[model samples]
Target chain A: MALGLALALLALVLALVLAVAWRGTGLALGPADWAAVRFSLVQAGLSALVSTVLAIPVARALARRRFPGRGALITLMGAPFLLPAVVAVLGLLAIFGRSGLLNRGLEALGLPTVSIYGLHGVVLAHVFLNLPLAVRMILQGWLAIPSERLRLAGSLGFGPSEVFRHLEAPMLREVLPGALVVIMVVCLTSFAVVLTLGGGPAATTIELAIYQAVRFDFDLGRAAGLAGVQLAIGGVAALAAWGLYRPTGFGAGLDRRLEVAAPAGWRLWGDGLVLGAVTLFLTLPLLAVLLRGLPGLAELPAQVLPAALRSVLVALVSTVIATALALTLALESARRPRGLIEAAVTLPLATSGLVLGTGLFLLVQPLATPMVLALPVTVLVNTALSLPYLYRVLLPETRALQADYGRLAESLSLSGWSRLRWLVLPRLARPLGFGAGLAAALSMGDLGVIALFAGEGQATLPLVVGQLAGAYRMEAAAAAALLLVTLSFALFWAFDAGGRRAAA
Target chain B: MLQLDHLTHAQGDFRLTADWSANPGDRIAVIGPSGAGKSTLLAVIAGFLAPTGGAVRWKGHDLGPVAPGQRPVTILFQDQNLFPHLTVAQNLGLGLRPDLRLSPAEQARVEEALARVGLAGLGQRKPAQLSGGQAGRAALARALLRARPVLLLDEPFAALGPALRAEMLALVREVADQTGALVLMVTHDPEDARALGGETVFVGDGRANPPVETGTLLANPPQALQDYLGRK
Candidate 1:
């Protein structure tokens, strides 16, 4: 009953917002809107295509070859996908920004410096965050092609290129579209990467445009107008993707204990070099961020700690709300089995955080006691924003629980609270904890809600870091960024470890 | 102990209708071809499936409305019989009380059950650390701890070697005998039926044959059972 009420409320509010945005301010696609839309699509397309193309070789190598640190490498590939986006942006900036290490080294070498503040910068950051994700997804695809097939190819005296042509190419063809679509969806809703690296009109995305329309101009009409456009574009993409999407069991039992034949000659060297270079490119930026931030840590004072505390508190609240919402939605879907509602729960993935923040601002600002509801509203917005990821993490596990234990629990007369406590909760503990931890970490690193709703006294850690970065307080920003990363990692580690221990 | 009356369930084009009853302490092995709704029958009785037309009664009470976990029943699936992340002790303990807040005697009971399964002192090990036979034993230990009136097995040991399958089957029979629980198992192999030595329920064409003594059924097999087993 409570779940129904929550779902109704969510649906009603979302519907009302959509109606207002639709009728009150019909989508007026001006030249700026057109540019933003086109640029966003182009950028997302390029990011997806590049990420998918690059991930293919890496995924193939990881799937078909083995060596020392193979397990660690596979594990490492999963890390960047989970790392807080803002932290990744900060790390990338510390390495690739104008005054960052790369430019400095280039200057020393008497070469022209590269600017990490344009389309290329946006693409770089997108690739940096998403390449590993694409690789992991595609690697699971490669691994899914039964090892026996590959062994048969080997037994047939197939050379490396022929094997690649027959086995690897088909696998790539099958996996690439899905990986690209997922990446495209990710890039469509991107806010932090564009906000950080995308400078001037040339690189601006629809999400950033939404932020500017609301925060800078306070023009709800234009913001709403752009939001309509955003929704239409996103809705169309989502619909198309949904139509094309085959629900492949990407991660199920892919971790088979299998042996592979060793690569020979240049094949070995080439794979090794590609793997090493990609690893270096991905890890060096974070290392640079850590190194640059260490000296600046001394400059951070008591104020930063309280701001960090505030961030953690807000994150905790948002995480709990988001997890609860996700769990309720997952369980409800399991019971009721609505495909569209399940897809709608993931609609936030297509809507940018900046757009969400804009919607919240427009929704709340007209209220008489908006000030009193600020913190709760902020947390709620964060929860809604992080809802997609929480759903992604929880839904699979929830479905698995339903598949495995639903029968047993039903036979035993367990239902409602008792059933949840005895059967669902115990089995779902690990995934629930993981999802909650992910929500918390994502919320902690989020700057979107704070950008609009946060008062002078309401700054989160990400907001503080953004402020410092905007004001050219690079060192202080670095310190706060590092602190934020550490805090996020610590929260995730604690929750994950706790879940494991509880399961044990 | 359990009764299913005119149980009919249809999904897409497939339909299953079985009317069956089992007395307390009866062990019935359900044997059939793939897609013969052998597992589906167990699932319906276990309350996992709500039949389109039927009624289920357990212990002379209508079980149509009872949820699976609270219906004095337990199911052990093929391989996911034990939660992987949990230690053997924790898995056994969960069968007692999911919260693991057992009384001292209850804890002792779990420990004793673990020992009976030959998993004593290895209760701290996770499912990943266990061999195939050991995991099956651990699953049996969990069922022992549950002490439920009905034990449902969906080919839990079918993947194990013949020796191991026999050992697990014997262990299950032993445990069921001790608890006096009604056991309904689904299997594809005739050898499993021979080892189990229970009443046989052959399901085909969406209907289940009446329960027959295993030895007699094997010695003078019905045409349907012969056809199914021979095809396999």
Candidate 2:
């Protein structure tokens, strides 16, 4: 029944999005639209290349070296991946925006001041968000390298370069392509990041083009055409990436520190410098946001409180729906391995939120004002979007439960609600918490759907921050960005912490 | 009587046959060569697996089509006898109510069962808090509280020391004697078979021969039994 419900929901999204996309079918790409498409490819390709290449050194340093706070640092790496794009953009701008600390320092040093809003800024934000993801993914590959192989290398008196050639190179080769492809697909749907940084016609991405087509141009037909292009591009990438998502080795994966022999001299210094620089690059903007937002916390924008409340409500509602849906869908799929339903739940991974919102706009414009229904639609879409991660988290866990104790439970006559409450729920509390945390944080931090859905004064916090930053209200924008970051991390930490305590 | 009437189980190229019955309260230890159908035979009777061609009758009732829980039998696997996440009381209470919604009277019964297994005043502690031997006792307490007509033990205490195994077997014997429930325990340990002191079934070469008096079977062992015990 849950499978049926989940399939029905997925079918609804696909039907609506496709119907609108197919409403007026012509592959006409105007120069501006072509530029958007070309820019999307160029930026995503460059971002994927730079993030994966840069991650090699950081992940290598991490795998062979165990310093204090190393575990916490690795955990913190996940922050940017889940960090709301609007908040991250603001953080970057706090340091790299026109009068941000970077320009200020450059002026003091008599160097040319560099602005952050442009192609480089967009690429920089992409790398900042995805570099940690790539590092974590490649580090998992390095960790997966059997300790015996490293020991063999050491026994053969192989130094770092030889070791890389003999062992690490092949592992990286196997893992890097999938990581690059996944990040590329993710960036293809990039909207908020590009919207905040990439200004003017030339720098626009296909996703931002779709947004402009609907909002500025009011040309639903062109918007629908761009959406199809996005669907085709993102779908192909996602399909190619379907069977290759073994990064970071999440959820119950025990990544033990391997005792690979560390090289002395030049290599050690090089690794140290790499680690220090990467840490600063990743964390300084965040620190700036915190430092800047603290002063403005007292004199917050009058509208922030209500927007914060609205954001919370949206997150809470979406989290409940996603968790319930994941539990039920996971339970059903556990009994019978329904690959199609699993695929349907994860289909949103390939979707662009702007495309979906545009389709929804087209679907409803004739009947009702899209603005009036924005928040509810945002909640529903966010819930649907979150289903994939939550579903992935729950399915394997529920299957393991059934495998380990299904027979015992059956023989004990522990069926129906009793079986679920006693056996299933208690056993699943940890993954359940983690999945819920993922859902809540993702929903809280998601500026994409709300950007499309929110109308007039119904703006969510991320939207409000983006607006503030755009309007040059840096103090309030920083404060709001800080609030957005805090809300996301706090929700995640609470649920994750709750799960640990319960499981303990 | 719990009866296995010409039961046959097949998986891939392996097949096991059992034609055996034990009267109520009969204690039987199933012994076999490696990969023989000792556990398979028990599984067939426990309703975990269906026989290719046979019926398991408890008293006069055909238990072939019944679910494992609905059947008048309970089985303890090699591990996971108690849910580690559940408290000792909740683990024991599952025997009474799967929902764990115990009445005061049922609650008293759970406490008494806990005491009966030598785990008195430890019902609130979790399985992880208990020692290995104590966990075994807690599992036995649940089995005792379950009080089904038949109890199938699949080397549930194989990890325990020999002294502990003997003690557990003695406790199992006493519990079975008190409840008048038939017991079938599968063990690879030869001393466990002898110390268990029951009618023994020697399963080998795709067949489980009928249970015979333990002392007689050991005194003049069958070829397969000699092959197993002769290893010493």
Candidate 3:
């Protein structure tokens, strides 16, 4: 019955997206909307290409080289994805923005000044957001090459290239297509990054175009049309990606740290450079965000507290909803083993957030104003959005529990609530906490949906920060962004820490 | 009698068939080659896997519809017999009450079971804190507490040293003596089968034959059994 409710909710939400997207009588794609579509594909394609190609070396380097902080570095690879996109943009802008560190460095070097806006800036941020994920995926690919295979290569007098050809390349071939599709789809639905960094009309993504049609034009017809384009694009891509998306099992299992012969001489330096440069690219912006945001912290605006509290409430409630749905769906699917239910839960990952918000907007706008409906819509959409991550964390643990101890529990006469309480719940504690924490953090900083649903004075922390930035309140915006990051990270850290300690 | 009545289980290319029966307090060693039907027989009897044909009956009652936990059976695998995260008492407590919600008297029973297994002072310790033999003892304590009519040991101490395994078998023998359970054990070692003693069921070529006296079976083995023993 619980499973039915969660599944029904998932089905209805998806049905709503499809309904709204296809609701209008005619499908018209304007030049501007078409530009949005083209730009979305190009940037996502470029981002996917760059991140994957670059990830190969980093992953290869990580696979063979077991240095100090390697474990920490790998853990940190997962951190960037959890970063709220708004904070990441703020971080990136602090480094690559016009008056930022990179331009300053270039100025000092007597080189031409570069801007962190428009097409390249958008691509850069997308790559920044995605490269670590790519590296981690590809690194898992490299580490997955059994030591026995490398030993065989060594015994057969195969050099590095031979090993790469005979061993590494094939694994990469298997792993990359999935990684590319996933990253592109991720890039396709991107709102916060594109909205912030791609400041010009020429750089508008389909998602950004949806936001524009709703926010600026207030043209439901145009908005629905653009949303249809996004839905069609996102849906098709997501479907293809879903078929291909097997997560490269990075950071899973104890044996990720394997010993292999790294390449010699220049290859060594090349790998080192990739590792060094990627680290710098990832870390510098966060550092910049930190340094700039810190000075403005003491004078945070009075508006910060209420927004933060509201955001927290939304985050906490949405987390509970997401966690509940994830557990229910995961448990049911694991029990009955249904493919369709699993697919429905994850379908939101492929749908555009703006489109989802727009669909809900189309559904609710006539009955109630967007502002009154804003927080609830935000909560609902965030739950839908966060369900995938929750599933990712919980499903494996739940399935493994069933595999390893299901019989034991059954044989012990543990059934239903007894089995769940004694065996399943206790065993699932860590993943449950982690999943809840992920949902909390994601919802906390989610600037999606809220953009369309939020009326005047209904801004979330991310929305407010964006507004502050738009109004050129740079210091306050930086400070507010810092607060957002801190709150999100603290919530994640607390739940993650709580889980670890409980597991301990 | 604990009966395996014309049982058959087939998965892909592997098929296992068994027809065996044992009286109360019988010690039966199921001996077979590594990939043979030894454990499969025990699994069917314990209700972990359904048989392709016939039923398992205990004391003239068909055990087919019974869930694994509710059946007159207690089975232990080679290892991971206790969840590492749980205290020894809690792990043992599960055998008494699946919920581990023991009243004071029931808790005392858990303590008594622990003491009976030579783990009197170690009930508070987690599985990780216990040595291999001690962990095995904890598993035995749970099995003892449950006092199921049939005890199935799937080489539960196979990882233990020879001395420890012998000690575990001795404890199992004592537990079976107390509980009057039919002890069905799967072991590759001929010595273990001999040590278990009473009767032996030699499983190979997709069939588990009925038990004969262990000494008689070992002395005059079938061809498949002789080949397996010789190969080992």
Candidate 4:
């Protein structure tokens, strides 16, 4: 059944790609199409480069230092993964917008005010979203360096520069390329960030261009063409990232504190500076979101509440589908450990939300009005988009469970729901809960497919925030963004806490 | 009778063949060198691996269509006999009903099995809370509750200390005697085979020879068995 489900997902994605190719065959690529492609590559490249480069010092500092709240700060880095893209944009704008805090401070100092717009703004948003991920990735690399090796280095009297050359630089060389490629692939098919922060002909990504071609121009053929471009880029990049990727051993090091060579004097101050600046860079925007949104909370626009409810519904439905699909795929793959199952599970990473939405739009446009299918399509696309992450999280636990107890359960006449209830569920409750929480939070904050499908009546909260932000209703947008983030977090916490409790 | 009718099995480059039968309530010790298909032989009998060229039969009927769980077989692996997350009682209860919707009588049986295995009051403790000996006893308690006709032991008590393992082996013998089940235990030690005090099946060089009396085989071993016993 799990293999069949995986094959069905694979076939669905393939058929959609074929449909896009078939629809787009007769259309000629325009200058704007090519420009969107170029801008997508450039911004993604810049975003990945900046995020990874900025991560090095911060990750190094985090790896070597042991202090109060270090673990909490490391935990905080995971918060952005659940934070809504629209909320992040609102927060960034609050700090760096024309009449915002940064500009106001600059004006008071009689300095030139910086604009948070165009290519830079888009990269800033991407960096804000992905820098935490890059730090975590690189930090995992640092932590994975054996304590014995560090102790050996200390005995050799190797100073900071020597340690860098032999120990740190080599680890970075091994890890950095994979991190860069993963981040780049993530940024390539970015729809929400691009939709809100990047637009106009020069800054448009293929994802945004597809949305425009459908929503503004009513050009299905052009949308298909853009979708085709997106599928190709996203597919290739995702495959590359998959090939380059290593597990990074992300969660194992939280409690296993490493005592590396902690150089004194200026190095101590330097580490402190790096930690302080990165914390501010990460936290200030979140602080700005809370401060800016708190006053507007009581007076949120009328559409905001309905949108929040719709988003929560979408989140819940998608979480169920994604978690079930992930569990099935994970169980089957763990039992068999097949490469094809992995390809099917990871297929979603290669197919972006907008691409799935566009294909669904094209398919549904013929049968009925696409507007009426908005929420369903949103749910389907969200399930597809989040399946890979959930599957990744669940697969290891499932594999471990199968290895340790599979035969014992089988020998006990434990099969079907009995095996699931008696053995698999209890053994796997922790990862299952975590992956479900992740899927729920991801779906809740999603702004991509919903934007493509939502008409005025069916808008999800993230879409409403985007619409508000687009209309320059900053106060209302901030409030809505706050509500969206709050709901996303609540869903995550409920699922995660529930899982931990069950496992206990 | 349990029959391995010209059973031939191959995995990758390794191969093993056995054409033997054991009567009801036989206690057989299968001893072999490492990687000599000792576990594979048990797996074929337990319906985990299909024999490449033969069939396993119980009483006069071929057991080819039987699922592992449906086979009158209870296997005890080296470790992980009990689910770590489950309480000792719940783990034992799984033997009576896979879904664990135990009736009051069945629940009483579970507690009785625990008492039988010397784990009477430890039923509420999770597997992680139990000591190694207690955990082994808990697993045995479940097998006692299962009361299947064939029990395959894949070195289940191999991690126990000498005294504990001897005690568990004695308990296993007692359980098999009470249940009137055939026992095929895989062990590396000749001492263990002697402790088991059953007819020995020497599995090595891709063939599992027919059973020999434990005293006779140890007294006058083949050159290969002698080499194996000497080397290890």
Candidate 5:
């Protein structure tokens, strides 16, 4: 009942805003809105299509082959999922920006300079973030194909091409649509990436436009109207994607122990080269951030420490809140099987943090003092924003647990507090810990809520980095960026370790 | 004492109607075909399901208004008997008290229970560290700690080998004897009924029968029991 009320309140607010903005703004759908809408769709479509397509061979190789550093490589595939958008953008800038490492190297070699702005930079950042995600998802798909089928194909003297034609292709066709939809939804709300790398008119996304309308123009009517448009587009996209989506695999009892054999000598070398080049491309910018920031570490003690402390405090509170909400929702959903609540939990994924931040600001600023409520409001927004990720991490485990343990506990009269303590909490400790770590790391690197609420003395690390960049404090920003990256990673690692210990 | 009067439950395509009763010390084994809803009957009795039309009474009081955990009953499931994250001692402790804050003597009781289950020194081990038979014993031990008047087993030892299954069945009988609890177990195996020597209740065709002598039922069974056992 409480969950339903919370969702109802959110929906009512959105509906009220839509009704008022529609009446007062007189904001008819216009050409500019249409252009922004078209650009958003095109960018998301191209990004998803490209990332999934490129991930196929890589995922196949990774799933089938085992070599040295396999654990590290697989772990690296999960890195981008945890990496903050703003931190990733900074790293990309350190490698691709005008005075960046690559451009400087090109200048030293007397070669032509490459521009890192506009569509190319946006696409680059998208690919950097989405590529690993796509690879992991697709690899999970490939790993799911029962090995007995492959062994039968091998026994029947089917060649590699024949096997792929019959088995792998069909599997990919089944998995691709869902993966594409997921990636498309993620890209549709692309905010920090576009804000940082999207140069001008040519690269602006609808999300960036909405942010501009609210922050720069202070046109509440226009912002509210744009918000309506944004939600409409998101709703339509989600509906279309829902039409195309299909469940990929059950993903239970997958052959985690299966190892792909290396190909013969030259073939192995070629595979290695492709893997190395892709990894280098993905990792170079992170390297640049580290290299550049190392020299500025002495200067970091002044501002970075305070910002780091604030980030830690915010991350801890938000992560705990997100975890609690996610666990409650997961448990409730398990008990009652509410599809609408699950969908509501995921709605934030399709909506950008900027849009949510704007809504929260508008809704709360009228009721409370912005200065006093800033920190809590920031934490609240961050927790709500992270609810989807935490829910995703916790839901699968919760469902599996209910399937396995529900009857036993119930028959034993384990429900309510007793059920949670004896069965649910204990079984879910691992996933809960993991989800909390992810929430913490994500909250730590968040710049969206902080961007809107933070004043001079109230900045988080990512916001501090953004401010430093705006002030042309390149070295200091780089140092702060490095610190942010380390902090986020450390937070995740520590929480994950704690989760493991709890499980142990 | 427990009673189920015209208990009927529908789960998706599966439906069950049970009319039965057991006295304080009666042990009933519900045997049925795979989809015959034996577990569903137990679930309805356990308060895990709201029957479409029926009444469950315990000790002359209607159980319709009581929640599952609050009932004077404990059940051991087929698998996932213990919480994976908790040590065996902690799992035992949870059955004694949900908050799991125990006094020294209360903690000693948990230790004694573990020792009774042959897991005294293994209390620190998580469920993953325990073997299948050990896990089953641990679950039984936890149920015993609950001190409930009714015990339910949902094919709890079906996964164990013949020897281990027999051992666990013996342990269950011993616990029930000591506690003077009514035991309701669901099983497909005639050997299980024979080994436990409980009253057999044949469940089939969307309904359950009253308890009959296990030895007589197995030796000179009705057509439904014959068919059910023949298939198995």
Candidate 6:
């Protein structure tokens, strides 16, 4: 039944979105809309290229070299990927905004003040956000090399170039396409980053265009058309990612520091330089956000607290819904390996927040005001978006559990609620908790659907940050971004720690 | 009586056919080679898999509609006999009530089964905390608590040492005696079948031959049985 509901929900949303887009203005793409499409593709392509290329040396350094903070640095690499996009944008702006540290330093050195807006700014923020993910993916490839293979290379007196040729280059070839495609799909549908730094006709992305069409112009037809284009790009990218992506077994052996060929002299300094520069680039903006937000924390605007409360509420509700739905889909699929449920769970990956929000807006406008339903709509969209991740996390564990214990539970007369409470829940607690934490954090940090539906008073924290930053209230924006990041991480840490304790 | 009435199970290309019945409290050993559908036969009886062509019956009633847990049977696999996350007592308690909502009387029964299985006062330990033999005892203890009319063993003690395996087989006999369960134990070892002391059912060549006396079958073995024993 839950599997039925999951498939039905995805089908219904896609049908409605497509129906509205198809029914509106005969699906015309204006010249400016075409421009938005071009900008979206170009920026995503550049971001994927730059992030993947830059991540190679850094992943190599981390994979081979051991230093005092090497373990800590690898752990920190996971932080930015989970860091809310709005918060990361605030951090980036704190360092690279017009009056930020970079501009001030350039003034001191008599160089021209550079603008952190348009194509370059969007790409920079994306690289900062996705660079860690790219590095981790590639590092998994490096670490996955068999110890026997590495030993053979060493015994054969392989040089660095030879090692790269025989070993590293092949691993990269197998891993790089996956990393590049995943990053491209991520950036293609990214709304918060582009909305913050990307503006004007030349820089607008499809998502931002959808938001503008809905909010400023009240042009539902145009929003629907843009959503169609967004869907096409996302569909193709998601398919490519699905085809190319390999698990890399990144979950295990990340901490097993391999003794690879870390040569001395120039190579040693070169690895150190790569590690240092990457660390500073990733950490400086975060530090600036902290340094700027501290004073404003004492005198946060009164509305920030309510907004925070609203965001937490949304996160909690959506986390529960996504976790429950994913559990249902996973268990049913594990019991009977059906393609329908798998397709339902994964289909949401090809649908964006703006597309769902716009279609839902068209559906809800005839019945009631979309503003009044903002938080609920946000909850629904967040649940749909995060369902795929939680499903992926739980499916393998659920399969293993069923394979091992399904018969035992069955022969013991454990069925229905009792089976779930006694057998499934305890067995699956770790993955359940971890997946829930991720869902909660993602929902809490989401600025997508709410941007389209929120009236003046119904703003979420990410929306509030965007508002503050847009008004040039950098200090207050920093403060809200700080609050948002703290709450998101806190929610994640609490759930994750709870899971570990339970499993222990 | 338990019946495998014209039971034929097919999965893809593999098939197993059996047409036999056993009296209540009868002991039978299902001995066969690897990939001979020994486990699949046990699975069909335990209601984990449906027969492709016929029905399973208990005491003249068709068990086709019964769910695995509701069937009048208990099956112990070779390993993972106990859930590792559950304590020994909770694992036993699940046999009494799926919800683990034990009344005071039922809770005492759980403790009694633990003591009966030589796991006395160790009911609080999780499966991980138990040794391999102790884990086998815990699973047997749960079977005792369940006290179903039919018991099926799929080499449940194969992981134990020789001495421990012998001891577990004795315990299985005791548990079967106490509950009056018709026992069907699947084993590859002739010594195990001999120790089990039952009518032997040879499952091979796409069929499960009905029971012959274990001692007689071993003494005047058929050609296929001779080949299997000789190869080993």
Query: What do the candidate models score in CA lDDT, each in turn?
Result: 0.78, 0.85, 0.84, 0.89, 0.77, 0.90
> Distance from true position, residue B79, model 1, in Å?
7.1
- Per model, how many backbone clashes are there? 15, 0, 1, 0, 4, 0
lDDT of 6 at A185: 94
lDDT of 4 by residue, A1-504 (tens): 887888898888777778888897778989989999999999999999999999999998888888999988898888898998889988889888888889999999999999888899999999999999999999988888888898898889899999999999999998999999999998998888888778888899999999999999999999999898888889889999988887643366565555554888998899999999989988998899898889999999999999899999999999999999899989998888877788887788988888888888888999999999999999988998898889889888888888888888888889999988978888888888889999999999998988888886899999999999999998888888889999999999999989999988
Candidate 6 residue-wise lDDT, A1-504, digit = tens: 976786787786777667656745477778999999999999999999999999999999888887898878987888876689999999999889999899999999999999999999999999999999999999988888998899889889998999999999999999999999999999999999999999899899999999999999999988988888788779889988978876543257876645555888898999999999999999999898888999999999988999999999999999998899999989998998987887787778888999999989999898999999999999999999999888988989999999999999888888889988888888888888888999999999998999999997899999999999999999999998999999999998888778778777
lDDT of 3 by residue, A232-296 (tens): 78878888887888765437752453545666899888878877887888888888778888999
Better structure of 1 and 3 per TM-score: 3
Residue-level lDDT of model 5, residues B1-232, one tens digit each, is: 7988887787788778878789877788889898888888877877888888888888879899888888888877767778776788988887876667788988998988888888879989988999999999898888778878999899989988899989999999988887788998999988898877779988998888889989988888888878877744
Q: Rank the candidates by DockQ, best first.
A: 4, 6, 2, 3, 5, 1
Worst 10 residues of 2 chain B by lDDT: B223-232
Q: Is candidate 4 or candidate 6 better by lDDT?
A: 6
Fnat of model 3, as a fraction = 0.62
Q: DockQ, in order, for the candidates?
A: 0.31, 0.74, 0.57, 0.84, 0.51, 0.82
lDDT of 3 at B28: 91
Ranking by TM-score: 6, 4, 2, 3, 5, 1
Task: Give lDDT tens digits, candidate 2, residues B7-74.
Answer: 78999998998887899888888888778988888888888888888888888688878999888888
Regions more than 4 Å wrong, model 2: A24-31, A109-111, A247-258, B59-65, B230-232
What is the fnat of model 1 with respect to the true interface contacts?
Answer: 0.44
> For residues B94-203, what per-residue lDDT tens digits would candidate 6 score against the true structure?
99999999999999999999999999999999999999999989988998999999999999888778899899889999999999999999988888888888799998
Give the clashing pairs for model 5.
A64-A260, A65-A260, A413-B68, A413-B69
lDDT of 5: 0.77
Candidate 4, residues B156-204, lDDT tens digits: the string is 8888889988998899899999888899999998988998888999999
Model 2 DockQ class: medium
Top-DockQ structure, candidate number: 4
Question: Which has the better lDDT: candidate 1, or candidate 3?
Answer: 3
Chain B TM for prediction 3: 0.97
For candidate 6, the TM-score is 0.98
- Alpha-carbon runs more than 4 Å astray in model 1: A1-6, A9-13, A16-20, A57-76, A82-94, A105-114, A239-273, A301-303, A332-336, A369-374, A414-422, B1-46, B54-63, B66-232
